[model samples]
Target: MKLKLCVSNTDVLLSTLSAIQPLRKLCVLRFTPVHLCIISMALNEPQAWCKISQEVFPLYEVESIRDNVLCVETNIDPLINALRNFDKSNSDGLSIRLQRRPVANEGPESSKKNRSMAVLSLIYTEHVSMASSRSYSFKIPVKVLKAEIDQGIVEPQLTHAEVLMKLDRDILPLFRRIERYKRSGYICVTGTNRGRLELSIEEDSRKVQLSWKEFLQVQQLEGETQQQSQFSTQDQDMPHSVQIKLKDWRLGAKLTELCYKVVMIISENHALVLHCILNEDETAEVTYYIGGKIQDQE
Candidate 1:
């Protein structure tokens, strides 16, 4: 398996990794002929999923016999730290190459048990002068998946949500309010298809509610999205409510800072999706999927 990638505009990658870095978990790097996807899937933590097209990168190549795709999971902090310290102007372009480290802690067996075994080396070529140039490499350790054994992942499929709204306000303050409730382990969100939303949490004898009267609705495709008349359709007008983990909700809030627009999708009491869009062209996006709190979990 061989995979190499180079991007002229590192802003997309930098911003995306920076946003999701707060999750502090290993992220999956999926390299295909078409695009690259960075994902972090966890049961108790917020799941972050995003896609970046090959067109976004001037150089993208992947070679593999099975499925013609390569998937590796690794910690993103090193890469983020390297980019943070690197001078963007001096960067000719960032080149990535996959390499196998002798001892991997990915699976069951390892020497130290905590060290990463595989890596995607980050190579930066810097031109010092007219004819002088310098090169630096940082090995961002990864866990390469075995194509024959591991089933690749796909984006989660959700039933059409009852309400999807375009939120324009910052959500940081809302999360701050929820933080004060020591007894509130979860946050209850109620909303209508017509753009009304309510977020609240309860602490022992106290209750705090934050409401928004109106907001822009998400544009839908012919079958995907349309109008849900609040007046005519009784069910459409009825608000859908779901309780999500306060911790995950707060993590979702961090995504808003990385996006140009924020969209919330609710599915009654089943699940919630926080769609964070980074660009208008849809070249890059980071979305968080939060499952509703189950009774037994409480």
Candidate 2:
């Protein structure tokens, strides 16, 4: 299998991955002719799932072994370390390729190892060279696991009561402020007929609420409009809140510096979904799913 893609904005891609690096240790990378996706799932309960996507990476060229799909599992740190070396300013362009290295025969009398090493070749050119362009490459060894990979992309199912809203401002600042109060907090989100949205956090006896009176845009998913219509008069005006671990919410904040916009979906008492747009064109995006915290009974 051969796969290569020329990255248009290396910084954006690297930053997105770095933001997700803390989510899990191992990441599953799936490559197709049209897109490249990085997926991670937390092993423990209150599990977190993230999927980062890059559509047309300036250039996309691929030759797959099985039905045009290639999946590999690799350590996240090493890949991030290798990619951080890229000098976005002086670099012309970056291209990544998947290759296999043949096992070397140790001796004439000994048989060669049957296993081949899978490597990711990252090649970038330095435009600083005057007479001749200098090219540097790093070959990172990645493990090709025998485990079956999911070919289709899947997101956590949302209930009818879920409210999805687009934020006009960056959420990092708000998240940072809440971090000082506690390690986790409940997010109470409310929408009004006047197109205003409010996000609040309550702790101890203090309640902090931030409002965007004219800055929010409500997004209607496939059946969301019909669902909203079913809401009773009081339910439509009441706040929809979900409890989330601050640690997990911080992960979404890390992407704020790299992503241009953040869209949040809160399922009252169920889950919090964050969809981050990484580029101006909105072609690149990352979605995060964090299960909500359950409140204690009164």
Candidate 3:
């Protein structure tokens, strides 16, 4: 299903959002003819933005779309650090804001208390439904739908309110299940040499601070020596070219067992609690402690 949305002006919205350092948040869009407000995550990317449109518009033909701005949905947080100068590297470019409204109060009410501001609006058509039952304010554009695809209209909007409701309904139980699973000895424990372990942990952080090759190398090393055994002759020869079908990864390289003492084996997800103890003979034993998620088997 396609999601529907309305914006004040695409150009101004993108331009203003590009200027901000942290480019993630619900945007308040204002326009003539109609004014609507929307969250920033919904309009951050084309796929996401496209998903919200109920009717797709053909941009080349529609002259009125010039002032329409599409913002993100109300919940997805923006990546402050991810904001960089706009680059047309991808088919759609870096996610930029539509137009933004200052978070200030209005007249007497503004001075007394806080009021939520309008971020963006959708262009409505006669066919669009505005009933609050399940209907939304954002309408779809026709220009964005001029391609060959199934279900051209907007998909259901993953609203902030909906996400919160889902979190409370489904995700919270799943989190509790995870906790119970960890307590049941389902998780695995693993670590590399001190420096290597630190590097591996750093690589997993969402900071985009490492080069692609560097990240892959650390992941490979940590994965290979997870079991506390000496590297096989094959592993010693080409550590990078080893082939091991471990869970989700197809090992890219062979491993060289240079250091055995600090090399610990573990499941990637449950590494915090379960430990794999391997002897020099390649035989192994797994020990589980409390607190972590279980690892999925390959």
Local distance difference test values of all predictions, in order: 0.75, 0.65, 0.24
Question: Considering only N, C-alpha and C atoms within 3 Å, which residue pairs clash in candidate 2?
Answer: none
lDDT of 1: 0.75
Candidate with the greatest TM-score versus the true structure: 1
For candidate 2, the clash count comes to 0
lDDT of 3 by residue, 1-298 (tens): 1123333223333322332213234332221123222222232221111111212112211123333332223322232112221121121222222223344445775643322222322322222244432212222112121222212223333211100000012122322332322112111222222212111111232321111221111224433454433545324322111111222110100001111111223333322211222223322222212222333468
TM-score attained by model 2: 0.77
In terms of lDDT, the best-performing candidate is: 1
Over 82-135, each residue of candidate 2 has an lDDT whose tens digit, in order, gives 677775447867788887754465554433332334878888887765777778
Rank ordering of all candidates by lDDT, starting from the highest: 1, 2, 3
Across residues 220-265, which tens digit of lDDT does each residue of candidate 1 receive? 3334233544335533455778889887777786677557888888
Report backbone clashes per prediction: 2, 0, 63
What's the true lDDT of residue 219 in model 2? 63
Candidate 1 local Cα displacement, residue 180, angstroms: 5.8
Q: What RMSD, rounded to one decimal, does every model reach?
A: 4.6, 4.3, 21.0
Task: Pick the winner on TM-score between candidates 1 and 3.
Answer: 1
